[model samples]
Target: MLVLAVDTATPAVTAGVVRLEGDTPKTLASRITVNARAHAEVLTPHILECLTEAGVVPADLDAVVVGCGPGPFTGLRVGMATAAAFGDALGIPVHGVCSLDAIAVEAALGRDLLVVTDARRREVYWARYSGGVRVQGPEVNKPADLEPTPSQAIAGSAGHVDLFDLPVEPVETPSPAGLVAVAAAALGSGAEPAPLVPLYLRRPDAVAIADRKK
Candidate 1:
């Protein structure tokens, strides 16, 4: 199966083409830009470049796997909207996986772990994982508030990972391989996809003019 995966839930605007066979996923091509403000500008070109490098066209994609973020609203909106547009235009199913879970899947070592991403306002979006499966939360809080144990290891946004004292995994963002791995089951089984929902754990930064007047 051929899958197109993209994630804009972190400072990295990532996109890739992956080929899945049996139980594993192999990335054919990928593009990543680490500018926090470039998702809208770089994402589409990244996807097209990935497909081109993979030697496949959009119609060859069997599915689209997207990182539905617990990220800042604007980034999540860009990623999810692009995934939806691709899925709609190509008539393929689009799967939404938690952006943090994608990082967890990449960092899994069959032990307790933590994944966190920048949520700005000096806060982070975090989740605890047991053997790579989400066992605790996809919650947002100030770094010190959720206190992790010394034995636990962590992965995800580099800026925020330093706040926790646990052992760290250098993986600072979601990879295309990790994104597809999170949705491997559904993609393999050909299950119907659920609604694509963005996990903006907090409200948008933008406020209505009327509400601001209050």
Candidate 2:
């Protein structure tokens, strides 16, 4: 099966094409850009480039996998919208995986992991993984504000762990490969992609004009 996966939940704009056979997934093409603002522009081109490089078109894909992020509202929507649009056009299945889980899956050993992404404003979007599944949360806050719990490994930006000592090595950011794995499982399970939903764990930075007037 051919799958297209994308993630724009953090500073990076990531997209990839994977060919899945039996129980494994192989990367045919992929790209990761760490610029926050380019997500809107880079996402579609990356998808097209990935498909072309893989020598497969959208119609050839069996499904689409997307990172449903607990990320900033604006940037997170770009990836989700793109994935949903492609799925709609191709009439194929699209599945959403936690972006943090995708990052955790990228680490060594596939053990229980705490994944975090910088959310700016001195906070982050975080989650915990266990046995290749999300076991704790997809929450938003400073790492120091998070519950102090033990983990087998850590993923996402290393800055997240600066406030606490952990049992495992810290991995910075979710890799394209990890995002693909999570998406693949969702597809394999016959999960349906809902309307593109931004997993914003917190409110937007902009206050409403009405509220500001108060």
Candidate 3:
């Protein structure tokens, strides 16, 4: 099956085309631009480029996969919204996977691993994984609030990885290949696609103000 995958949960705006044969996902092409503020501007173009590089068209995709983020509100929306739009337009299922899981899926560490991504405001989005499966949080909190096991290794954005004293495995962002690979089982089992929800973890910084007392 031909699948298009995207992830914008970190500074990277990522897109790719993957061929899933049975349980394996092979990345045909991918493009990533690392800029926190360019998600809206760069995502669609990246998607198109990935498709072109993979020698496929939107109509040829059998499914779409996206990273549902525990990330900043603005950046996270771009990926999920774009994936949903493509899925709707092509009449294919859109699968949502945790942005953290994307990174976790690619981790080569042999021990427990912790995945962290910038959440801004001096905080991070984190999860604990063992054997490539998430065993704990996709939660957001200050780095100091997290307790990493003595043997745990870290994978994620550089700055956040520095927050921990552990050995950093250095994974800056989720890859499109990882995003689709992690979702392959669900897709194969015909499980319902994940809801199109942004895992902002916290409310947006901007909020409505009530009218002044009149």
TM-score of each: 0.97, 0.88, 0.95
Per-residue lDDT over 67-172 for candidate 2, one digit per residue giving the tens place of the 0 to 100 score = 8888888889899899889988999988877888777766755556677788889987877777777778888787678865667656677666655565545556
lDDT at 12, model 3: 92
The number of the candidate with the highest lDDT is: 1
**The 10-residue segment with the lowest total lDDT in model 3:** 205-214
Model 2 regions lying over 4 Å from their true place: 108-111, 167-170, 189-191, 207-214
lDDT scores in order: 0.90, 0.79, 0.89
Off by over 4 Å in 1: none
TM-score for candidate 3, please give it: 0.95
Ranking by lDDT: 1, 3, 2
Greater lDDT among 1 and 2 belongs to 1
Better of 1 and 3 by lDDT: 1
